[model samples]
Target: MPVSRRDFLKMAGLGLVGSGLPATPLKQIARNVTTDNAASMLYDATKCVGCRACQVACKQRSGLPAEPDAQGLYETPRDLSANTWTMIKLAKENSEISFVKNQCMHCLEPACVSVCPVVALEKLESGPVIYHPERCIGCRYCMAACPFGIPKSQWEENLPLIQKCDFCADRLAKGEAPACGEACPTGALIYGTRGEMLGKAHARLASDKNYIQDVYGESEVGGTSMLYIAGVGFDALGFPRLKDDPLTAITWPYMKAVPAVIAVMASLSTAIYFRTHRDKGKQNGEEASDGSKD
Candidate 1:
C-alpha cells in the first residue's frame, strides 16, 4: 500500500521528462504602423539649459494636473511622478552643472512588454512603450521590469494606472513632433528616426573632443529610441548602468518557460491525486473480500 521512491521517480519522470523543450519563436507583431520609419528622440545634455519647459509642456499636453506644495503653490516635480510624465534632474560634478531629462527610454526590446502578464504594456512601431490602463490590473510589474524606472503608478486613486511618457503618440499620428521636442529651445532635444539620431549623436561627439565618447542608449538595453549625448560622463547625468543585452532578451526566455513549468506541475499533481485514490479504492475492495471469506 506504500509507494516506493522508485515509483515517485517514475511518476515525476513521466510528468517532466522531455517536457523541457524550447519555446516556439514569438510571432513578430508589427508594433508600429510605419515599418520603414522609426520615431526617436535625441537629448544633447551639453545644450540643455535646465529650463524644465519640456516638463511643463508634457503636463500641459497630457492634461495632467500640477503637483501642489504644502503652501498650495504649483511646484514642478524634481522627478517623474504619477502627475509628471517627464522631469529634469540636476546633477553637479567638477563644479559643472547639467540637467538630465528623465522619461521613458522606450527600448527596441522592452522588458516591460516581456514581463507584463496581461499585455498591458506594448511596444509601438512608432518607438514608444505605451500602457493600456483599462487592461492593466494595477500590477506594478512594469515598474520592476524597466531599467530606467520610468513607469510610475498613480496610487492615490481607487482604480489607478501605470503612467509614463508615450513619446506623444497622438501628436505623431497628427504629423507633429512630441511636446518635449517642440519645447526644447536650444535644439538639445531633437526628434527624428533612430538611424538619423544615431548619426547626429556620433557627429556631435566627433566634432567636439570635449564631449563624452559614448552615446547613451545607442546600445544600452539593446538600443533605445531616446538617445542622450552628454558633455559630462553619463553617470553624472543619472543614466543607469544597464546590461549590453536587450532587456527583453534577458527576460523573455525565462518568461516563455513559465507556462511549460506550470503545465508540468499541473500534470504531476493530477497524476499523484489519481494514483492515491486508486490505491485507496483497491485497499477497500480487498478488505471487503477478506470479510466475505470470514
Candidate 2:
C-alpha cells in the first residue's frame, strides 16, 4: 500500500526501511505483568542525549551482533537488521532535535504473531514479544506483516530465522530490567509495569511543557508495552499518528481469501494434469494405428 507522506516520515524517522503498518493500531495493555500487561519501557526524548549507551548495552546483554555501518560511520547502524535488535535514531525539526530509540513495539495483538503460520512469535505475559527460532519456516510473512517492520531475517545463515527485540525476555524471566533500560544513564529509558509506565508518561505530559501532549505508543495499534514522550510533536520526530485498531484487524479479512485461492489453484492444477495425460495417450494410440497401416 502507498503510504501518505506523514506515514512515510514516521518510518523514516525510525530509520526503518520497507516495514511498518498503515497507522492502524494496539489495545489496553494488561494491568499485571504476569497476566498480559507485564513490564514495559517508557522512553522520554527530552532527556535523551543520543549517547548510544543503551544500544551497546543491549548488544552486550543479548549477545546480538553489530553492523557498525560497514561502509559509513564507524559505530552507528543505519537501522535495525538481523544483527542489531535495537537502534537509536536521530530526527531534526528546525533548531530542535530529538533522539528516538527504535525497537519492537510489542503490540497487544501483534500482527506478526497473528500471521505466523507456525506460531513462531508470541506475546509474552510479562510484556515482551518472544520468538522461537525452531518454529520458523523462513516464510518472511512476519517481516511483511509487522507494522513497525521490526522483524529481520539472518540472510547469512544456512538456515536463517527471523529476529527482533524480545524486550530482553531472558532478563525479564530473571526479574531484571531490560539491559537497555538499565544502561540508560540519563533516565531517558525507564522500566516498570505497563501501568506504571503509562502513569509516568501521562504525569510527565501533565506537568511539563517540554513533552508533547500525547504518549506515542499508549494508544497506537491497540496498545504497546513500549511508550514514548517527546518534547517535539511525534510527527516531527518521525512517529506515526496511528489509530487504536490492532494491525491484525486491518489484515485478517484479506488474509482469509488466501486459503480459498489456494484451493482453487489446487483444483485447476489437478484438471490440467489429467488433461495432459489424456492428450498424450491419444497421441500414442494414433501413432500405433499408423504403424499397423504401414
Candidate 3:
C-alpha cells in the first residue's frame, strides 16, 4: 500500500554495483561482540491472538498515520510499507491457525548494509539496523537486498525515502522495550537481551512438544535481533529458509572494490576523451595553418 501525505509528513517530523574480486573470507567479517547483550525480541506465534495491539502501538509510537485500503474504507495493510513498519499476518496449516508478525529481521550481517554504497544502513552493536535518511540516495538497494523484503520506499511522496523498523533504538537507549513488545497483552512478544531471548526460545522448544523445534532468525543469515517460533512450519508463515552464513561474506569484496572499479573506469574515460579531443584540436590547428599559407 502507498503511504499517505500525512504519513509522509509525520515521518518527516521524526526523520550498488560490485567489482570483480575474490569474496571476503567469512572468518574476517568480525561479528559484533555486543550482539550477545544486544536488545532482542522473541515472538511466540502460538500465543498470538491477532489482536493487532502491537501494530497499532507501532503506528502511534512511530507517528505514522493510518493507511487505508484500496477502497479507502479500512486501514488494512497487506504487508510492511513506509507507513506501516510492523504488522500482523495470519497463516493457516491443516486445522490450526497462527498469527505471524512481519517486520525487519535486523540481520547481524545485514545484506542491506553490505550492499549500500553510501553506508546509509548501519548495523549497530546493540542489534538494531538503523537508517540514516540524510545519507540515503534513494538507490533502493536495501529494498532489494533485504532477504525479508522489509525496507520500503515512500512512493507517494515528492521526495521518497526508505522506512523500516529500527528496533526502537531510542527506547533501547532509554532502557525501555519496543512499543510493539510492550503493547502485546498476550505475552506473545517477549523482549530481552539477544542471549536471553535465544536461551528462552531454546527452553520453550525443549519444554513444549508442540513447537516446530526450529527458531526463526536464530541463525538465518547469521542471526537477527528479532526471533520467532511457531507451531506451524515456518514456510507457512512466509519465512524463507536460509543458511546460517551471512550474505555479506559473499558480497563484501565486490562491494569493497566498487570505488576502485569506478576509479579505473573514470580514468579510462578521461584518457580517451583527452586523447580524442587533443587529436581533433591538432587537426584544426593544421587546417588553419594551411588556410593561412593559401
21-122, model 1: which lDDT tens digit per residue? 322333333334252268998999989998888988998999999887778776757578888888888888788888888899888888888888999989
Judged by whole-model lDDT over C-alpha atoms, candidate 3 comes out at: 0.87
The residue pairs found clashing in candidate 3 are: none
Judge candidate 3 at residue 160 and give its lDDT. Answer: 94
- How many backbone clashes are present in model 2? 12
- Candidate 2 wrongly placed segments (more than 4 Å): 1-37, 69-73, 251-294
What ranking of all candidate models by TM-score puts the best one first? Answer: 3, 1, 2
For model 3, residues 1-294, the per-residue Cα lDDT tens digits are 243433443444453123244542455333355887888999999999999999999998999989898899988988899999999999988888999999899888899998888999998888899999999999999999888999999999888999999999999889999999999999999999888998999999999999999999888878888999999999899998786768776666666879988999999999998887877977788779777755
Which candidate model has the greater lDDT, 2 or 3?
3
234 in model 1: Cα distance from truth in Å? Answer: 1.1
Highest lDDT: which candidate? 3
